[model samples]
Target: MSDVAGTLPSTRPSFLRLPYLRWGLVAIIQLFLIAIPLADRFDVQRNGQVVPLELVPVDPRDLLRGDYVIINLAINSLSKDLSEGDKIAVGDKIFVGLQAGAGKAAQPVVVSVERDNAGDLAMSGTVRSLTENEIRVDYGIDAFFLPEGEGRIIERLDTSRVLLEIAVTEDGRSLPLTLLVDGKAFQSDAAF
Candidate 1:
């Protein structure tokens, strides 16, 4: 009986017995989760079409959050007619068609509730407000972070000359890529 007690089979599951294997699986899963979004952003950056939008600069400073510019694009407000008679309500997802202007910058040409109707160079935005004459949309790329102490230089510049260059995928996903002030690239301190 004493020998049998000493040799009793262990009750713990096989996976539980190997702690390192279990932790390694957890670490792999965590790494996989982190890689997904990073890969998506990389894909957009690599494959998306570059579009430059004129900026409607607003006061861009947050005392607590460090230096960053609040980006307001000229396309934020569109003529109601651009909707092509589609009733756009607040909170509705809409696509705005764009046409290249004489300059490199693109201009909004039309708006539609259906992505297919928005043409090739369209951008996706959420309708923020609707009025009798105009529609306002939020494109989510509304903030550009600057290096420490650099916001002051941007704040003093004539914001009308600022342009935000964004890469927009066919599916309407957009990423802000560069800032141009007076037709020249504004060097950003952001690592990526």
Candidate 2:
């Protein structure tokens, strides 16, 4: 067969000329971008220790961002003494050691600037602020997205009964695993 201009068509496969092939490549790239983070979280969930934390649920809805619970862990603020004389400043990476409480939740027992000095149940966090008597940290597990219309249910529940289950890796990386409301698992609609 000849081209409209009476020229023979090139024999080499042109990827750009094949719409399916081009779209397939695009789809594969997107899939990989999504899969990588999910796989990392799965690894943490599979091998890390489960640490339960008492959650202080704050505003659960953002009109512009859809439905999700903003989680504030009781352990977010620790006494400066927990650092054991280590100088802590804003933006410093620190590890908070935890011990099982009388209930299912784990309580922060100590804080260290070094991972080696932290306990077996340590969580990695970034120091957000520091005062003369207190240090505030962010664990990066502060939100739990829920299905549409479910944020209200969580907001209405007793805040004292809410708990967050987190999987903490040895390196101090953490993944929010579940939300417990009155000791029952609260399902989330988030895909990752």
lDDT of 2 at 74: 92
TM-score of every model?
A: 0.85, 0.80
Q: Could you tell me how far off, in angstroms, the CA of residue 188 lies in candidate 2 after the best superposition?
A: 4.8
Model 1 lDDT per residue over 1-192, tens place: 368876888898888679898899899999999999888888778888878898866556777777888888999999999999897899999999999665468999999999999999899999999889999999998888877787778788886778888888998888788888887789542225
Clashes of 2: 0
Which sections of candidate 1 miss by over 4 Å? 1-16, 59-65, 188-192
Q: After superposition, how far is residue 157 of candidate 2 from its true place, in Å?
A: 2.2
> Can you give the lDDT of residue 116 in candidate 2?
88
Q: What is the C-alpha lDDT of each candidate?
A: 0.84, 0.85
TM-score of 1: 0.85
